[model samples]
Target: MSQSPIVLTGDRPTGPLHLGHYVGSLRQRVTLQEQYRQFVMIADAQALTDNMGDLSKVRRNVIEVALDYLAVGLDPAKSTLFIQSQLTELAELSFYLLNLVTVARLERNPTVKEEIRLRGMERDIPAGFLTYPVSQTADITAFKAALVPVGADQAPMIEQCNELVRRFNNCVGKEILVEAQALIPDHGRLVGADGGAKMSKSLGNALALSADSAAIAAFVRSMYTDPNHLRVSDPGQVEGNVVFTYLDVFDPDKAAVEELKDHYRRGGLGDTVLKRRLTEHLEALITPIRERRAQFAQDPAEVMNILRQGTERAREAAAATMSEVKAALGLSYWN
Candidate 1:
């Protein structure tokens, strides 16, 4: 029988994943695991490109992200859940791949450019930060993953990875590396509670998957609706309304949600009433995930063991690929 196609995806271990993650990638991961040979990486090394000063935070969130993964139904039995920094081969591969790329090319990557601008590092971008696309190239090619699920903003990174793939294959006179394609989520991006263009943990505008009932309620109450919606009898705009945006994704009762939107637009439904319904739906959705996360958090050792085993499996695959990569570049000397 033919083997399943490999799918590589991951999260940076800087913070607990939020609803943005769920809507953008997490939900897709749960389904993809059943159909693909999936590898879910906890990207600690990449997280440290900017967070080098906060090593503890990065280390701590590795387990936190793993917990989130488990809570959301990413079965280790189906998906290889590994820590990125544990695989030394990936770093070695990245070094060789870096020679194939240039500073000008890295700067032109839209995802990298936006990240640098967001961190206010335009004047002082870290070397690692600037060249991370190469490292990402190493991560994807190491696993020979054909499918990489990512946000729309990350399309440039995948393009850069494929460029290196084609360049390295041409230099070697053969296709030594496999190119990857990005799988963007259909829901697009989930807006932040404050109505930002995106929901981000660092921005403090996200609702985490592990949030409690009180936190969920508070977040919903603070959600950005029509600013002109000052009273219960005013016609409200729903286009950019964060509450309806979330309801459209989370609330299963589509007909009810549409009716609520109609009532909201016609000038009788209060923001408080709408927010209360949203809070209830969000609470119902999150409570089970939070409980599962708590169960896993109670057994940190088992979680670490799972990561160790996954890393070992990942190391084997990476080591095999590195050997081929070395042979292609004529670096395998002691054979």
Candidate 2:
């Protein structure tokens, strides 16, 4: 049987991906590549919406993010991996989607509001940052992507995209755009090593995908556990402990993880032992990815070539969609 139509998902190249990205979406992306038509976008333009002044950082990190994808085993043969700014359709589609979505609607979006607060930009929010949801509609619909994988916190973004899709199709009298479904993971969020609410580079809590073994080991070693479990004999709280949480996600030995949790909760299981085990588990998980990343790093030209080929394919698809979109809106007559 033929496979379902394409699914689009991606990340801004603000930083290397972390464990939160892995558990929250990237791991799923690697697996979904086999089942669906996947287009993995490196959203450099989207990153610039927030980092407008830091063009050099955004430019540099695109390569970093692409390398991370390769290190994680995202096969270019199976997944169309490309940079976002390379396609002109996104700009055109963004214009159309903006007209469909109101400024009030963008303001009401929960994710955008939260981000404004988080970035401390109550009054000075960049226009591009405010309009990214519209741009994202462009990214998704530019390829007519049917599925958009995201975390719960990002569901509103997908809702905004679909809302624009429906409005555009209805207004133009054609189903030219596809409505994308949000695929949220079972793990709602992944906490950082410092026990922050989320794993992030800005917070100094991320264990980067490209981190060397010593760096990974240090981060894992310094990871937060149950603060109340100060003594080995003290009963520990496993519910929110970072170590146990990591164990829950990465430990293939579920029975052993359960045993460790029980022992820790009952007292006598020290944080040191649990932390060591978590470190070992993380090492096993990260070592191969790091090794693969090193090999890819040795051939930067080859990596760029993969990205270039993917960009060409993505541009073709985006161009076709833009032609239909323009024709639907009577812009084709202008040419």
For 1-335, candidate 2 gives per-residue lDDT tens digits of 23567889999998888878888888889889999988999999888886878999999988888988999999999999999998978998898778887889999999999999989998699888889889988999999898898888898999898899989999999999889998887777788988788789899899888777688778878787777888899999998788888888888999999998888899998888877787788888888999999999899999999999999988988999999999999889766
How many clashing pairs per prediction, in order? Answer: 0, 0
Evaluate residue 37 in candidate 2 and report its C-alpha lDDT on the 0 to 100 scale: 86
Please report, in order, the local distance difference test score of every candidate based on alpha carbons: 0.92, 0.88
Error of 2 at 87 (Å): 0.2
lDDT of 2 at 172: 96
Quantify how close model 1 is to the true structure by its C-alpha RMSD in Å: 1.6
Residue clash pairs of candidate 1? none
lDDT of 1: 0.92
Weakest 10 consecutive residues, lDDT, candidate 1? 1-10
lDDT of 1 by residue, 8-84 (tens): 99999998999889888888999999999899999999999988889999999999999999999899998899999
